[model samples]
Target: MKAFCEEYNIKGGIWNDSNFRAILEATMYLPVTDKDYRKWLNFFFENCSYNQLLFNRIQLNEGTENKMFSDRDLVVQRLEAKLLRYTDAKECETEYCLKLTSVFERLDLLFNNSWKKDVLDLITRLPHEQYNQDEINKKLSFIYSNEDCDDVLVQIKELLGLYDFETAKSENKSEIRELLKYPHYYKVLVITGTTGSGKTFFVNRYIKYCLEKLKIRDISIIPYVFDISKVVSDSNLEQLLIHEMADLLGKSVQSLEDASKLLSYLPIKICFVIENIHLIIDEKSKWNSLISCINRFSRYEEFKWLLTINGYEYYALEDISNFLQRYCIEKNSLLNISKKRLAIFQHAVNMDELNKEWHVVETILQKTLSGRMSNTYVDVNKGITTPLEALYFRECIEGEEWVSSPSTYYEFIKKIFDWKANKLAECNSTTVQSTVLVIVDCVIEKLNCVIKDSELNKSDLSCLRSVQLLSSTITICKENFSVSYGFQQISYRIRVFPYWAAIMVKNRFRSKEFKVESITGYPAELKEWLIPCYIFYNAQNENALLSLFPALKKASLLEYALFCAQRDSSVFSKALYNFIIKNVDYIKSSKRCYSVFYFVFYCPLRISQKFKLFTSIAGKVKEFNLLNLYSRVFKSVVHTSKKLKQLKKNMLELAPCDVLDINYINGYETGEVFMHLSNNEEKSFDIVINDIIAYIREHESILEIIKNGNNSSFFDFFIRKCMENYLKSKKKI
Candidate 1:
């Protein structure tokens, strides 16, 4: 037996503590020697005793009992178990050494080797076997050498910047409790609200509630807020996810596969609160990965996902797409919270619970009232709390100075006009100033000039800067564009602001002293130039009669007045008639007389009323010889196929001479000669002749009277001449 033992333990003696310790140290290096194995065997053989009685009870059958005992197999199996235990211990020690080396390397990079020895000693004393590399790095990343933690804390407080007296929603409270108790019922919950309506604030409160009330693991809660505008521009999905995970887990997930594997085996429950999730619409690929991960890991029964979105955009998208609607929980929790907060603010302000704010509210109301502005501008109703409203209310209580002051009502009016003009300016970048000047000129000069692109230039547009010389101007309403209509074909329309003409009059000449008398009795050139300006100003101020007379350029003034006569004829018809009759030569020579006549003849007035006004004005005008005006009216009536009979009736009713007047007879003769020479079908005398023939046929009395009259030779000669001329003109054509 001694010789056999010597053969096994050749390098070292067995059955001693020194040999056992040597074997332990050698196992750190692999491939142990026979001497070491024998030493381990000898140590166990001496220390451990075998149960011989139990082993003897395991008797084999008669035939198998003759086989060898094979004690080598038994010894080898027993020794392998002890060797495995030693290998595991050594592996753990090796892993620690490797991690320690990595830590020192990182520390050197972070601190430049300063205080490395002290930190190393402190970490060595601490038990960090359970912490990961990411966890340790995260904790170390926060610790700075020369800075105090309070500085960071102050910055964090500023960034949070939430309002005091934040309203809490009852529905959110109950739902949060329900989630804590039974999270499996809801796979996703979405919180939505308007911009600046506190969607993010509400979600933050919910997260705080969960953290304070529930006992979720500190590492398992992840809160990610996304900015849609930035994400849509960049479209980088992996970087976004990696950064968010790194923020939460103190480490980045390299790939979805790695994340899936880690999340699959994690025993703790995880709650992911994602805000501004509408940004996911930017990257469909990232959305697929995130949604798939949620779906797959949701079966773990420990994962919960919560999302927030802008209800304004979300509901609009939901109408067209089911992607987000599938995850929508139909509840007005956001609105409820808003109402609650508004109530709190209202109560605080009304009851003086915050401070004395009644004086501030009263001051705002009084200033707006005195300034002739609407009082509803500052009215804070229920179910809405905006940042502006909050600022106003808070400042009122805190006694901060209000920005706007009193005694500048006209300045306020000017500010409004400036704001509107600036807003309209944004539509056409190159033509903003030109467009604004065109509108301003149209209102100021009272000219009905067509808005032609060819006529406008940069020089005309330079007035915009002069108009905005005041610093208080800002852009107001949105702009609108469409096609212009008229005889000219303008390609685009510059929408004249609603109440623009009225507002212009108010801004320039709205004072009570600038009455219509100032304009009506003005000089001829000035009155003619201010025609368009007076139109709107008079319309708004009920001074229609005061601007009716024309001192110079009667045709142009009459043309504009005739155009608007149908709208308000009380101010125009009498003056226009007197002007035309008094200045008959101007009406006859003016080329635009036909247009003016067309407007007046087609104006929406009773035929009898028109004839009365014309006769009254003509009789009153001094030296108003009716020959030239009557000739023009007669010639114009011949051209108007529709209103010819109406003019004839008006002439008969007003003259009292019944076609016997010498001026009318001469005018008729001239109209007949012109009609014969022209032979134009549009202006043909056939309709007129047929109508006259019909009138003669209907009134046989008139034909008999003419036949028996003493002036029958003149009538016969007129008839024969008219027939001959009509036949001759027809043959020539």
Candidate 2:
């Protein structure tokens, strides 16, 4: 600061000049000092990313847009004229030549990063700036993450072709975009996928493709996306559409005629996006009203609809007209793990997991990037024994576990009860202790007990959504990535987490409230099979479960049970094994031996069953190709795990525990960890867990991911990793 000012002979201190932005801006161009330059650059990158860059691009110079900086001298001339208008030009060049060169060198690295690429990409977009800058950014903000290596629109086809869309239904999964522009089959495109399946992410990527990359240039493609999940439930669909369109156009619209007239005045066609259509489809009136509005809008050439629906609710819409159904894309939850998906997910959750994220990304590409598979299983009831079943388990694991799979994110929706949510909406109305208690009440109590779909069928949840891995934010401290992370809320919809989270929550708290005795009546979830399945699979003994929900031939109960086994493998394994044994005669007579064998193959068995089941199935094993099933199950497990070897190396860097807590552990036969093969010494993790218990006991920001994330839900995963690390250190492998 002193050198530049002294050399320039300025009269005032740093804070003396209120209008020194251009001076500061020019200083950013030059490396004033080694440490100072990095600090400024980090601030510049963080602050200027999407908000202020476009505005400055125009303010820097107007005529430069048309004139080519054909020579290096010309760019320098322009920079001098705009950035140093108040300073003497001859002195600027002569005095700061070395500093100027360093600035140019640093700019090279910046351009190679996404910001400069975004500018260059926008420049190439032809029709001479016909695209509105705000609208373009508005669309990109939803789906665009610079973290994605393959940000191009065509990368979406790699994800689309791997699903059960109408195009791939009669055939195999292929890499193709559902909204085909060449054949012009695009109209009211309904992208359907399970909860954890990435629908909104894919839709936004496709939107970006349409806005900036789509090559059909004869007509201007105007794209608009709205998350109507909050407002769509009770509101009139027709009036709401017009109201939204009115707001977009900045005009008053009282009727459909007014909206149609406004849209018709515009030259370009509107690709209007409606998100979370699943919210309304459950109500026959709302779904029919939406479909009817689409029918009406199809008559007008002003706008077209692109809607998203959850797969849990999509099955009810199967009876819609064939023409519209052809455009319906059933998102395959099977084959997806892009370089972009992994990077964005890692950022969103702040989960680098031993910094092996990209290594896992590469492995996934080799497996699914080119070759395609049939994605058939939707829910977990499909059993873990068959090839498709194994594929389903691999693709559908939820939360941080599914971080490596294809991720389709839309809104980083506010948890209805987070401190941040309260800060933004209500302001100091809720305390941190109350927030954690709220989560415990909502997740552990509300969820673990007899929860029905009818209870959840309200317009909005009184509590935050609990069935997901918590969302995270990156913290900056004038250096490389920081270890500190912030979480929005903890949730687990990566397979609805119907299996593990339910079982884990019950055992961690050890509540009789969730016991099998409370299984007095089933909820509407029996139709959906997620919530009821979660409750039923939690039975301590086999009799309560078998008596409550039996695996009838075509009934959904068996599917629910299989889902439990696949997700909550350790807990469900013994119960499923006993149930399967009890129903062995019925299963054999019904030709359901394949599902039984699948359970035997992957699920953890009681030591007694492990030996006895092998003896009982010994004759049938040869007839059923059980050897091949064993190979497939293990192969799928290896594929889903993100390089366990590297993770094991990093997970247990902390000192090995002398005592391990039973509640914090899984996959063990008993509530104990042996130090040696002789089982003479037992390790206890009380020392390790006590610190966290103390923190959670004393800390008020207990559920806040930034303050107490280390002791939050992820601690369980951390313990599991540490256990693996400890096992590796002991050469247990």
Candidate 3:
């Protein structure tokens, strides 16, 4: 076989009885750096297709058909000997060189069918809160017995329930078992719950239990569970179910009709679990046909169905299934734990002996502690229900040390932000540091959402629960700015903020901000930490802009700047405006000047300051010929009619050459008034006659330039370029 294989350029000789042990020993002794040996090893794998060739070569005794492997099992024995030799050699370099021991162990597991032990150990060690170990073991056993089924592989991995924590649902499981025992009594069992209420988890556990019960009863039951969310197309569901049934029952199903026939004729029982049924529940015709098909197969005691639906759509499904109401055996709504039970569960989680869930919490408190807890803040008598809520209340009570020294305070707040980010990253996932940074970005997004909602006076605290953020009324600004002229009214939701978020803002204001370029690259893992620091900052401070790092001057960084500076508010001032104006060239070259332009209008400035800020911006706009700047002014500039009139009066006082730069801006702003004059497109601009006359009279000097045709471009811009858009809207009517 060696000579034949060599001539044919094949590697069959490695598996031959005469060469198996010899090749194993040769590879074991060979150096990893040896080019010829590496080539030979690669060639062996290329020809062998893993352990298949070796398995086929092992001779077996006759009538030992069900035995998974041959009695000789020389391949595993030789591999084991080679592994022992490598480990016993006591040489670190050689250990690295011949690291094929893992491969050999895998081969051994396959031959001896001992992979189940490793799987069981993994299931046992998995976070108990996320998955039930016994249910997982049962699932693995069933999958192991039916390994030939294509869906079994995916089912095994999903049953392990990694990447998600599991909530206890023993009550739901017990109810499901009672219904599943009498399969003939109910054609379908529907598990209903809100999204994330453990409906799918409950159904998965129920299916495992039913499969185990069937095994005990000596009934041939094949379980096929599919999450409808994974189904991509309209027809994919029917085809996948058909294919899975065919594979499970060892029969052919060319179509739905074929599958129905196979189910009818098959004497064996089958359990089918379908999750996220709400996805297709709204399809009246499709849902009716699907139900009819299930009803057809329900004629036999061999078929049983378990379906899950989102509770929000439970009423919709009730309407759709009016005809099949009698066949529906159970409609169980999975619910969150009650407040009393929640307290018990949280206490259990905190005191968990296996995982030591509270060990990390204790570590965080130690690292971030700056002061002793205060009785006024820490209400010891307040019974904390959840572990997370307890942590929140603990932090609220244990206020940070108020350092009289600036440097110490800066360091203290920075440590707090770092600790919060790191702790949140740990709680979310066991991701490496590189990936943890990326996940922390969700903090910024959540913070932005909270700030946006706060601006609209619609900030609701419930949304912050997932991120462990709490919202309290914070008076960031002492003075109450009027909300007239499109300025956001100061919201009462500002004062009390997430403890972690307040630390981040404090750090930013103290000139200890994190590198946006460095931190922004990491995935946003936590939401509470990402809350915008600018939202709670002392916006009234004139030195706020100066305190910001140069790296944060970019558009993306400025996007986090809240537009809270109204006329009387001191969020932005002349000093900051002048500082930004000095960097006009840098600002113009950058793609994001909108934030700068946004600051100009979003900030409340005197009519004189508004013109001064515009003049500085308009100077660069003229130099760079920045047309978008003028367009944005029309689109975004917010002001009262009085302020608008004052600005018009100021512009009219300028020379024709000076006014030329702002002509398009004034034209667009004036034209927009006519656009919104009436809801009906056909309505004449007669309603805003007084306003238009006032605008024309205020800027008569600019209009004079247009009338004389001295600057024909300015006249054509307002009438043809700007006013033409409103004309087009009228034509559409």
Candidate 4:
């Protein structure tokens, strides 16, 4: 092989002389008289492992004859021993070892075909020394045999049972055996109770008992735990269950269609524990589909089903009475464990005792209501003296008097139980408004901010505040402002007050404009936050704007343009035109107002006709005989306008020149000005004009500017001059 590989440019070698010899010996037994057999032998000798070759030879012997092969049995036993030795060498975890042992058990079941005596002897000698002898003997008693019962098949069954129990517990072995023995009895089990009634616990315990006590392992049964909570959408419950089963079994479930295709191939004897069956039951159309699927499972001789639900007897059982009767009653295929099971559960949780410890009951209730509990407050009438009548009452006892009662602690337990029951009952019917109120209250308390629900306007602020409050209520808001908002909304409308007062109280000290800027972007940030409050105040009182002091001061010239853009886009355009015309002299005289105008007009009005107006005004200012200040201001304004137009095009497309829009514009313009000053880039009027045209084309919403018949040609002339000046500047550069 090495010489041939060298000649053909291939690398090949064999290691372990004993393994090579084992492959050679195994290949000799492959009935190699035929060409195909001889070719297979050659391939085996060339590449197969010694253990694989030995296994193949043993399988061939087993397949050659109908009778059980002793050689095959001995080889399998040796393979099992080898696997045990390998596991021992690594000191594998128990789960790992059990997986290896399961493979051996499967092989023995397939190849070791013999009487009970031989199987029992093999089982007794297996390396899994943890086999329960008593359970094995009990399983052996069930294996039928003729005169002086052949112990081989009986022993094999016992061994298999013991192996399966040690490897992985079987959940529905007893149910299957009972069904097989008493086919006339109903096999269906319908378990129902109130929420937190321990139905799931009872079913799990029953499954555990069968796996430990009966030792009827190797029963191909799958216990599927189906949570109906996920079935809210239009998903097929059957396909979902099958997919879940495949996932738990570590098998491929590519799609719902694929899951359906694999369902029939699944082992017939299986237990499906369908939890929260009410989800399907309530959707009548879906209930029909679910029933159809269940009927199919019932038709299989070995299939068993278990359903768990809360208050299922309320509607589900009644709705599906006919279907339930046919399968559960006539077919002896259903079992109703709701009532009897509840009694058993009551015993488990000790609910029968009236004198339970408050702490113990509280812990259990808390666990049961995980992710569902809400902090709720009930108003109490002044005349009501009993605890039950009091808003914070513990059960029926008066809050003050309850603590003095002999059963005070028990009363607390009863109160929690009653509260939990009421909460669960209200989950579906609670109004959106009431729910929002509850959530907002909790959020406010958590944030240490006092808030009253009545103070908030439901129609205006409810939608936004409710979402923020609920998110905060869930303990997801870790930021300081978010927490403060929750507290303020719940306790008081701080954002509604004058910006200065709100800031002073909110920041817990004297809050300057600069300080406010540090916390919330620039003046625009404070202005935007005040808009909603202003709108709310305006809606209530027309002169509400008078109450807004800091907001008025914080509203820079640019923000004023934006505020008009939001409230009146037409007014915003006109105001922007006048502001640019008035500021042209100042911007051209010095760079002080140039930055402010660049931010207001060039940035916000990039897509508006206001850009043309600003450029035209700047050109007029530069043309007029003022002083050297006019030239300097015009240069600064023109330079900054070029960069501002470019920055605006990139950041804002068809941006509304409103306060909100200008806030984003301000940030972009600031960055652009910084970049220009740092890079010392020369500016061109043509470049600036072209940038504005490009921005206009991108934001087609502003194309109306070109169509406006009044002074349309004047706008064109203004842009043409700017473009000419820009191209001239570019040539110089």
Reference-based TM-score of each model: 0.25, 0.30, 0.29, 0.26
Kindly list the per-residue Cα lDDT of model 3 for residues 506-529, writing each as its tens digit. Answer: 544245455444323323322222
Candidate 4, residue 407: the lDDT equals 16
- Global lDDT of each candidate: 0.37, 0.37, 0.41, 0.36
lDDT of 4 at 562: 27
Assess candidate 1 and give its lDDT: 0.37
- Where model 4 places Cα greater than 4 Å from the true spot, the runs are 1-187, 210-220, 232-235, 250-268, 312-315, 329-407, 414-733
Worst 10 residues of 1 by lDDT: 346-355
Give the 10-residue window scoring lowest on summed lDDT in candidate 3.
346-355
lDDT of 1 by residue, 80-174 (tens): 33223222211112332443344323321221111222222223233333435455444444432222223323322332222121233555435
Worst 10 residues of 4 by lDDT: 399-408
* Model 2 residue 647 distance off true place after TM-score fit, in angstroms: 31
In model 1, what are the clashing residue pairs, if there are any? none
Q: Residue-wise lDDT of candidate 2 within 84-138, one digit each (tens)?
A: 3222222212222333234323322221122222222222232223335454443
> Could you give the candidate ranking by TM-score, starting with the highest?
2, 3, 4, 1
